[model samples]
Target: MAIVTSKVAGHAPGQPRGGVVQMARDSWVVARRNLRRMTRIPEIVVFGLMQPVMFVLLFSYVMGGAIKVPGGGYREFLMAGIFTQTVAFAVEGASAGIADDMTKGLVDRFRSLPMARSAVLAGRTLADVVQSAFILLVLAMVALLVGWRVHQGILKALSAFLLLLLLGYAFSWIGALIGLSLRSPEAATSAGLIWLFPLTFLSNAFVPVNTMPGWLQAIAYWNPFSATVQACRKLFGNPGVDGAHAWPMQHPVAASTLWSLLILALFSWLSVRKYRNAVG
Candidate 1:
């Protein structure tokens, strides 16, 4: 009998074959796959943009008169919040996609391949980010039709949009974890929204947190959702700027950046860990 020594089937002996470069390549492959699927199912993109467009129209027309924004009209104030809410709600799609993959046994198939484990989740979240950017573009056009303008220069406006995308990407990790834990796509969709309602509603996304009860006000000001909304408002030069005393409201850009980074770090780790144990 001849004894043969070789590296474990997929991995290199001295150094791991697939390190950061492999992860990036594999992640892009997965992202491209998901993006192609979206192109085939156009409804996903259409419906995603539709809901936010409806919100822009309904709120700008119906409640625009009732709401009072400091130094600006309600439509202007509402656009940032609308943008934030729309991006935040994008988690539903992320969760549904991941859940669908798991339910269809695609996760197991991927695990059998010699790819980085993180690629699965990273690709899913990256695909969601691309979808979100498209939605934002459509929403921005609709916002302009409804009389929302970015008074700040183009650079600032771009920054606000980038911040919204970053926030959405961070939130997608939460969806990724939910999808991994849930049994069905339907369940993942429901679970994703259960907490999102309060997170978006309770914050300054719609109304001023100062209007809430004293305790609720505290929570809203400290809420990460609120931080992003406020940052967008400031960067876009929209109205509805209250809570000058609160750290988040005062330094919203920094606050949003910190909150997004923290969420991404925490949930990405958790989701990847869950993914490692999940397929088996």
Candidate 2:
């Protein structure tokens, strides 16, 4: 009887037990489910990729001539900014996805399951990260077609891409929290992007921070968005005006890393707490 009970419990002698490992496994399962839904709904991926590609063409052709980089061509300088903006804007899709799930009673369904409480939010954010990665890849191809090149070697370019993904992943947590707070997906999408307009445009994403007014330039230099953009510029060896003596612009890689980590840690905690409270 004891042997049968142990076997039924799945407590094999050499197998690892549950806890965080089980939570992660559950999260991956949920992530895969979300990915499958994205695949099934081809428009989601298609439209997501479209916005960035359009921006690349519009900026590279429409504004490319008007904007001047200090030492390099504007097309090369603009790719990092485009990459940063695209990934940062990924928060909209993340928030909308979560809010849609909530409205469809999917959260309630997941709550009824024997799964980790954090898995739902974690999985949603992970799936969004994957989506953002795909968008970045498509945008990169578009940028190359527009004559954007990474002057830095492959290693540095790869590091830049990693940083962009990390920033997007971190921002997705903020979206998760917003989605949990909102009742409808439409509301989440609007609310999610409300601040991002100023956040992305007011930063160095589309223009040189030095071109802005003195006070606005200060704010832009300190903006977390600017930090990542500047970091990518450094990594890709793209030409743009260097940041002033500001700490973030002066040491973009470290600043981007710290900012991303801080945002991820803070928002992940808040999102998980909000999810639990919402479900309860």
- Which segments of model 2 are wrong by more than 4 Å? 1-18
Give me the displacement of residue 207 in model 2, in angstroms: 0.6
TM-score of 2: 0.92
223-268 in candidate 1: lDDT tens per residue?
9999999999988888887755889989999999999999999999
Clashing pairs in 2: none
lDDT by residue for model 2 (27-115), tens: 99999999999999989899888877888888888988999778888888888888998888778878998999899999999987768
lDDT of each: 0.89, 0.88
What residue pairs are clashing in model 1? none
TM-score, per-candidate, Cα-based: 0.93, 0.92
Runs in model 1 lying further than 4 Å from the true structure: 1-16
Lowest lDDT sum, 10 consecutive residues, model 1, at 7-16
Native-to-model Cα distance after best TM-score fit, residue 262 in candidate 1, in Å = 0.5
